[model samples]
Target: MTVTEISRLALYGYQIPLNPPLPVGRQRITSRHGLLLRAITDQGEAVVELAPLSGTDMDGEPIDGFSRESLQQLQDELTTLQPQLGSTAALERAAGQTALPSLAWGLGLLALKLEGQLTSRQPRLAPVPLIYRLPNETADELVQRLATLPRDCRFAKLKIAQNDVEAELRLIYALLAARPDVRLRLDANGGFSLTQAVDFCACLPKGSIDFIEDPCRESADCEALHSALGLGYALDAPLNAPDFELSPLPGLRALVLKPMLIGSPAKVQALIAAAQQLGVRCIISSALESSLGISDLAAFAAQETPDEAPGLDTLAAFEADLLVSSGKALCLELGQLPLLASWEAGC
Candidate 1:
């Protein structure tokens, strides 16, 4: 069997500022910190990111909802493997041993890129649909925001279960009244109990929502909530569960696939195959990665779910760009980030 080869490698550390701070779960983050990997192999040059999402309040209580391991943990793992990172065999072995999804994914992508198995054959630009996430704003503000959206943008996602339930309901009703052509996707981030989710769903007008994502903390509870309301639902964190299984559920409509949170490229393709077999839509979503990472996701979405609109509207939160300019649309291009280390195979 022929193995992939990486003769040179470089690592970069970045602290891109997030304009207005991005809120996830219980914490608001002013900046995003992570590492970038650039490698030279027989196929050509390849780049991938290792940005793990974590959420902590000012008091540091560990509220990370998206990432399974902290950023420090990921860095520690990389540090241990730094000695042999230039060897494709070493990267493959380390990827097999690590439980951290971000690390495994980074290594896996490196291998794929080295073999020229990704993007080289796929279309450079795929016209996938786009979903815009409405920022938190008052009724009038949201109305103006909706009015400014591009004519082709028809779907919108809103974060719920964070503030007053009644107020959120009113805001949704008013926003829809202003632009009834837009379909809404509500994300609760698994913040509600079964009863709470049911009660919240009951208040919304029937057929007003396309789907609700991560309505409850437990997958069972999420399924039960779907049963109670007969509303379509999408799975997010459940895709990262240690014992996640792809089975048929009555109201299961979509799987929110975040490559950073998911283990490896192989596993991601497997999940997509299984989900599609079960007639569930697969949505390639982002984990607030930098422009480089977001561009990678745009390529992946183009190759995988070309027909579905991806949830990649998080790029506007970044204050500056990485390798590319901050204002450009998503594309498969690598730009220079702050270098942390460089290694060449025999040097």
Candidate 2:
């Protein structure tokens, strides 16, 4: 197999339902919104799908940093460059681009290279845990739903915001009462003030909650929140910003990596390596990407040794019909999710 020709590119937009609206910090999400990038070879026999994070909005808007503009620009550039270079060189150049779509493009290009070479190695994809979202209904209903999930799904995450402290806490208590053996994590999404975050974490019983993520507004709050909660803390949105320097947040247990927001895999790997050196755990999570993007992230996660169970379970929030009907399944077993197919035609 040799680098002979480049073919076509296609972008597909998809909307999938969330069983129950997912509440995270100040935002209430009811569906998974994203775009899929497909690269086809000249042979017309190979295809690679890349799903970079398109945020919650499917249409390109607000053209700011980390917006859909980044993806569009990368696609335009790749289309222009593909005709000028061979397969391997194109992939290398695509991988090194400064644009946001570079990671997804690189992953897709690598998959293409593998197909061209007829390599038997399958792209790595680890099982992602499933996360269930609770509706804004009664705590009893939420508990009942939890009881219905498969027994192997013993780890779950819930969203909290500044306004719903009491309700959230009550919900947490109810969940614990229903399944005491489950590990629970709270994602605040920077909804609380420093003082409020301290008070909120302090209200929880020690060891009842596993860890809380991004409760406060500033990176500086990591130490303060850790002290207040008397438990481990993780950073999500804070890590997404490039201006924020990466250092070990005191009392931090895990650092969540969102590749689309961070721009590239090498950069994410660097952060993960730094966190490990500082004795902090690393977790690779998605920003509600399509299966294309999720597949790439899952492959990267499979390469990680001793990584924490990531927030990839957010996939369950959507209806399955929205995805390609013939691809891999997203089922979880013993808290792990299996990888989906990379090509629709079995390339």
Query: Among these predicted structures, which one has the highest TM-score?
Result: 1
Using lDDT as the measure, which candidate wins? 1
lDDT of 1 by residue, 155-191 (tens): 7788888878998888788768876877788888888
Cα RMSD for candidates in order: 3.6, 7.0
Stretches off by above 4 angstroms in model 1 are 1-4, 55-61, 82-93, 120-137, 326-338
lDDT by residue (tens digit), candidate 2, 1-347: 24444354444445556666544335455665444444566555333344444444223232222334344565555455544334544554555564554444454345444455423322233333433345565568767877676676656777777446797788788888887877777777777788888887887865767778877777678787776656788887776565656775678888877766665555677788888899987777776665545655565675663345656655555555333231425432211222221222211
Worst 10 residues of 1 by lDDT: 123-132
TM-score of each: 0.87, 0.74
* Candidate 2 ranges with C-alpha deviation above 4 Å: 1-25, 29-33, 40-85, 101-136, 243-245, 305-307, 320-347
Question: Cα deviation of 89 in candidate 1 (Å)?
Answer: 6.3
lDDT of 1 at 280: 98
